[model samples]
Target: MHDLIEALLLGIIEGITEFLPISSTGHLLIAERWLGHRSDLFNIAIQAGAILAVVLIYRERLWQLAMAFLRPGHAAAMADARVYGQPPREYAYRLAAAFGVTAVLGVLVKKLGFELPTEVAPIAWALLAGAVWMVLAEQLAARRAAVLGERAAITWTVAILVGVAQVVAGVFPGTSRSAATIFVALLAGTTSRAAATEFAFLVGIPTMFAAAAYELVDVVGSGEAAHEDWSALGVAFVASAITAFAAVKWLLRYIQTHRFTVFAVYRAVLGLALLALVPAAD
Candidate 1:
């Protein structure tokens, strides 16, 4: 009973934070520390369900993608970002590029296992850096109302630039991939609403799916998370999906009137609190 209840609470937490620009990874670490539960692959695997929430929420667009890229008659430049005046798909191409860049860079970094220790300090640095960037992001959001008109199209230049930003995001688990990419979008003249919401879903689609895929591979190869635990996985996933959907809706509404600085500040404070509280072994 305790295990199941703990699973539900953590699932809800993951669902809430996963979509937010604040770091879910950081929150998970904090949860482990505070909950006093032995963390395991079960908690990590629950993210697959959170990922599914995004995919299913945007099922309409994903279906459109199936038609756009898979079918020959679909000439919707909407997917191209360069010519399509419509949102998402135009934005999606940009996201794909960004995800691709991050994937390549992340893979290389994982392979090299660079001399720089994978310490918790980087997470602290990311939280602090993201907070500082949020101040700039607010200014960009205010300016974007007038700016996107002259720069309507999402050009390859912006794609590459956003991609580079994603690479920076990948290096630091607490940086929040959605926050990084959306900041790029907002700075590049996409409206705050469009950039914040679309970038959240668009970049998140591939990013989350890829992460799920990799974890699946790891689980398969090492039996880290068993196929036999599918039932438990399902429970966590459904809870996560419900929570994620609610969180995404709330976040979209919040971004309309609120600047991101509050969340950023929260991340920094939380990061510091964790550093002070958690033992050095962590």
Candidate 2:
């Protein structure tokens, strides 16, 4: 019963923090230190649940992208007719390029064994750094708003830039993937918050699934899965899915009217609090 409760609590934390500019991994690490750590497989699996929520929420867009990929003639017709706001083909290409760059860079980093500390102190520092970047990104976005373009108008250069930012977020624990990608898009001249957020999450669906798959395979190969608590994991997975759907929905609505300054400040305060408390907790 205690384990079940812990799983649900951690799932709640994961769902709430995952889509927010605050790092979900960082929060999970801190929470686990108090509630007891879950296995890597369990963590990865619950993330898949959160991803399932994203898929359900964006089913319409996902269906359109699927049709565009499977039917080249339809894509061409849409492009020629300009039926959709943006050519599905162009959006598809940008998604591929952005995901490709991150995959390549991420694999290389893993091959090189470039890993960071999962310690709370390091996460605290990373949170501070991320906060600074967020503030600066908002300022830059405001200045360039007039000249900025929408998601469909993103160029190859911007896609690559945003992809690199995703890679950086992967490399750094406290850096939030959504925050990094969205800011890079904004800085790269994406004026519309909705457009940037949409692209970021769309690309995120595949990237996250790939990571979860890799982790699951590794755990299974290592025979670690046999030791995990399946019941607790199931509870966490369901809890994460429900909360993630709500959290993401709220964030999408929130960004439509507000700047990211609130998130930035929250990061700063949380980071400072962690810096002070983590050492004492030890």
Candidate 3:
């Protein structure tokens, strides 16, 4: 029962933090200090649940992207292409480019055996650094938006940078993937907050699912699956999906009117507190 409760709490944390410009992995790591450590497979499973929620939320958009290729001359596809002054399949192509970059770099990172640090001090430092990065990036993006009037077009440069951002986030546990990608897109001249956020979230769906699959295969090959608590994992998965649905929905709406500065402020405070507390605890 206690384990189940812990699973539920961890799921809620994953769901709430996953889509936000706050690091979900950082939150999970902090929670594990008290709730007890979870296996990498369990963490990946909960993250997969969050990814499923994004999939559901963007079902129509995903369908349109598909139909754009599968059925040329699709009305929605034509409209999108016309508005963006690009080919009918441009959006899809950009998404592919971004995902490709991540896949290649991600594999290289894995091959190099660069693992996410589990230590609190490094995570705390990352959180603090990310907060500073967010502030500076947002200011630059806002200035660009003022001049460009909130352009929605994603340039090839933006696409490639966003992809690189994802790998950087993966290498740093406290750097939020969504935060990294979205800000990189913004800084790379994708001025519209909504557009940057959508691209980041869309790209994340596949990136995260791939990572989760890779981790799952590794865990199974190592025979660690046999020791996992299936019931607790199931509860965590369901809890993560439901909470993620709500969290992403809220974020989509929230970003339309607000800047991401609030999240940066929250990150700064939390990071500093952790930094102070961690040394004393040691």
For each candidate, what is the lDDT?
Answer: 0.67, 0.85, 0.89
Candidate 2: TM-score? 0.94
Cα lDDT tens digits, model 1, 1-282, are 665666677788889988788877756655755554432456556677678777777777677655555652554544452223544455567667877876887678768775322356667767777888877776766776665453445656656666666666666677877687777766766564554456546666676667667756775678765544555555666788889888887887887677777888798797787567546737
Q: What are the candidates' C-alpha RMSDs? A: 3.8, 2.1, 1.6
Per-residue lDDT over 1-282 for candidate 3, one digit per residue giving the tens place of the 0 to 100 score: 999999999999999999999999898988898899998878988998999999999997888777778886774545554425445478888988999999999999999999777678888888899999999999998998898886888888988989999999989999999999999999998888888999999999889988999998999999999999999999999999999999999999999999999999999999999998896644
Pairs that collide in candidate 2 are: none
Q: Is candidate 1 or candidate 2 better by lDDT?
A: 2
Residue by residue across 164-241, what tens digits does model 2's lDDT show?
A: 988898888899998999999888867778888888888899889988988889999999999999999999999999
User: TM-scores, in order shown?
Assistant: 0.81, 0.94, 0.95
Question: TM-score: which is higher, 1 or 2?
Answer: 2
Cα deviation of 41, candidate 2, in Å:
1.0
Q: How accurate is candidate 2 locally (lDDT)?
A: 0.85
